[model samples]
Target: MMKKNRLERNSNSYQKQSNVKEVWRRLRKNKGAMVGLVMLVIMAAVLIAAPLFVSYSSAVGQDFSLVLAKPSKEHIFGNDGYGRDIFARIIYGGRTSIGIALLATAASCIVGTILGAMAGYFGRTVDNVIMRSLDIFMSVPDILFTMAVVYALGASFFNLIVALTLAYFTNYVRLVRSEVLTLSEQDYVEASTAGGATSMRIILSHIIPNSIGVIIVNTTMNVAKIILYESTLSFLGLGMPSPQPEWGQMLSESREFMRNAPHLMIFPALAIVITACSINLVGDGLRDSLDPHLKS
Candidate 1:
């Protein structure tokens, strides 16, 4: 009996590892995804390591004589309206925009997963209560909801994250709930129930683990959306406050200088686009890699 249980555990572990290996194998074959993966890795590394190489003062210090200077050896991306280094600001700005968006999306995913698991697995009153309560949030347009929250809370980093997370709540909840509905009916889930597992245990140890790939894919895609929203808020002057170099705010400040110094708008806009697109590409690849139906 002991030997049989050990073999069963080993088999489950091997199967899980094999699935992970297969996903990686498929991801490697996707050219666009691989490119996105590389770009994201390099960009994130640069943002995290930028402070080590460039002083923070370079991003904020003004140089009257160097204002609006074009890209050159002195400043690879040139000086902004305040004569601050564009490259340095971009590196740091990315840390705020991407970092906050990523964290908010992750928080949203966890919240949605928990609520979704309860609704989908339990059904009946539990389902109605969770789903109906969330409907109030879901009914509002996400952007407007986010705007309302940001407006009420005041537009700071923490408020932005809170707004984004709540605004994004519906997406993952609906997704995970639907997934759990189907997964709860699977044979392994039934087997676990027959073996006397608690509902929470089966949901946590079985359902949620199986649901991870889908949740992850959705979360990856949502990061781009959150970044865009953050930028929009910044552009509207409701994002990170002045003196805090966010890409959207950077673009906002460059409005009057479009004809005179197009570089001001161009660089920041590129950073937002490149970051969002890279994440999107990765999400697409992960979706294809993890879903057998999408395999080519």
Candidate 2:
């Protein structure tokens, strides 16, 4: 009986120490966030399931015979200037855009966490050098920096991801740095230090773990911004090369026939807007849920 009671007490203590359940409970109460999550799930499902039903050729294959064809029973969203199905292109394009954004944000988060944790934990010269260098990066406009990198590197999938990763990592560096500064001062951190734990171990094993909640919340919110940046680059002709179905590329191609066929612009624009908005909603919900200070 004593052993069982002790187990129960330990379980309750662990539950109190871990905010995972509490965060989820608060998140579920957010209607906009739930709706956004549903939208994201549907969007992702549609993107994944689409290729199973529609041939890949439909997205890139051109038949001038059907050029500028309006929506019909055969072509749901109608054919593009290249006589490709707009609907099919959008499904594939969404995968590309969202995929790129997710990869860039993830890369940024990893790089940023490492650097930020170092700066915060080491302090003094390490902090000065890291923070000063990041300040130089932050001076440039993200779009212009991304554009220049893409231009110099010559736009391709990998280059775009690299460019975006560089453009975004600074944000996380600052965010995580601030978070780590506080976490580093915690009693556990000092205890670990006094115990002669390696600086790297304490930063990685202790500081980062404590501050991960903030980093994750911020990373979630940054996705929408990265998506917009990618689409903008694609629109300006710096994105994926022609014949590849990117949303912005689709928009660029459709601009010529906007008066005659507005569906071209409408659908792709809607995809970007809806996807970004849904992500933002979920990000907002996460921020609220994780902060703990905010009341429902």
Candidate 3:
């Protein structure tokens, strides 16, 4: 009974400690970042709730009479080339673009983290080959590399995710490998090894947990980059096709109408800009809070 009580007490203490260390605590201290976080959450919520609130069948549905209409009670962001509701299109289209970005970033992080952990924990030839291969991948501009990969694979949502993972995973691998290398050399890691812990156990239990701070920060920043990449792909005609209501596709389609219906370009551009900026602001806050060196 006494041992059971002691164990319960210890478990409660651990939970309390973890709660205290949550990212929000540090994030709250940075008012600007907190505001950005809130804005991002609101944007995501709005996009997710779009289908529930809006009644347009297709994002590109046209009403010739409403073409080039300005913002009003009926059309919040005005009408676009095909006379579709710019506001509705943006809100719904965000779901696709943002979804793609998140999935691609997650794929990159997982693959990169695994490769990096293996290379760093088991150095020598393994490290050399992995790092050298990553170097080759990273040598080219990511956008160009992604384009080449997508061009070869042909552009679909799945292919886009693959291209992004291929293009961006090298960065994650490099960062994670560097962090693992640094952390593995620490005395605690050595101590764990000396105490008969297996290489895998030490890597999972000690190295990975300690290196997660870096990973979290990098992942947050990568989310914004992923969004930008998706937009670029759409702009280049390699992403979602027309009438799909994608932001990049919208920007490309609206370019010609810059002189007449500038609202078409303006609204989509603002969506991409504001969303990316909000993500970056939150990421910056996380980076500063997670890394003691960056904390001010």
Candidate 4:
């Protein structure tokens, strides 16, 4: 009996390992996802490494006399309206842009996940109250809502993050709630409950684990959206304040001269588009890989 139990456990372990390998194999089949993953890593490396070599802050002393200087030997990407090095600003701005997006995503994911878990786990009145509040937020257009929140809280970096966090957290709650609702009714969940597992334990260990694949795919997609939203806010003067050297703010400052210096708008816009696309592609690939039914 002991030998038979051990053999069965080993077989189960092997099956689990095989499943993980299968997921990776599926992900690798997606060429664009691999490309996106590589690009993001390269971009992250540039951001981290560039500042170490360049001594000045993103927005440092500028030479107004040289304002709107086109790309040349001295400054590869040229100078902005304040004559700050455009290349330098972009490099440094990466840090802030990526950092804020990450923080906002994290904040949203955590709050949404917790709320979603509670709402789905405890249905009826609890679900009604939480979901109705979510509906109110959903009723407002996201950008306008974000703008209002930022305007009210004041346009500092921390406040902007807080505003975005609140705006995007709704996605997580809705997603997790849907997953939890489905999983909570599954046979495994019923078995857990029958085996005397508490509600919290069943929710955390069984329901959450089952829902993680959906959560991960949603979170990855949200990262890209958060980045775009951050840039938009910055562009509108509602995100990073002036002279801070953010891509969006940079675009805002450079817009007037866009007719003369097209490069200004081109580079930042390209950066935003590429990054967002890459993230989205990877998210799609991951979602496919995680869903066994989609595997072919």
lDDT of 2 by residue, 1-296 (tens): 99998997899679757678788889999999999999999999999898688877999999999999999989999998889999999999998999999999999999999999999888999999999999889999999999999999998999999999999999999988998989888998999899899998998878888787788888988899999999999999999997888998999999999999999999999999999999999999998888867754
Report lDDT per candidate. 0.92, 0.92, 0.86, 0.85
TM-score of each: 0.96, 0.94, 0.91, 0.91
lDDT of 1 at 217: 94
Clashing pairs in 1: none
Quote the positional error of residue 108 for candidate 1 in Å.
0.2
Cα shift from native, residue 152, model 4 (Å) = 0.3
Where in model 1 is the C-alpha error above 4 Å? 294-296
Q: Write the per-residue lDDT of candidate 3 for residues 39-77, one digit (tens) a residue.
A: 998997898778788865646688889888888998889
Per-residue lDDT of 155 in model 1: 90
For residue 102, give model 2's deviation from the true position in Å. Answer: 0.4
Question: So what's the TM-score on candidate 2?
Answer: 0.94
The full ranking of all candidates by TM-score, starting with the best, is 1, 2, 4, 3
Residue-pair clashes per candidate, as listed?
0, 0, 0, 0
Q: Return the TM-score for candidate 1, rounded to 2 decimals.
A: 0.96
Give the Å shift of residue 6 in candidate 1. Answer: 2.8
Candidate 3 has an lDDT of 0.86
For each of the candidates, the C-alpha root-mean-square deviation to the true structure, in angstroms, is 1.3, 3.0, 2.8, 2.6
How much is 25 displaced in model 4, in angstroms?
1.3
- Lowest lDDT block of 10, candidate 1: 287-296
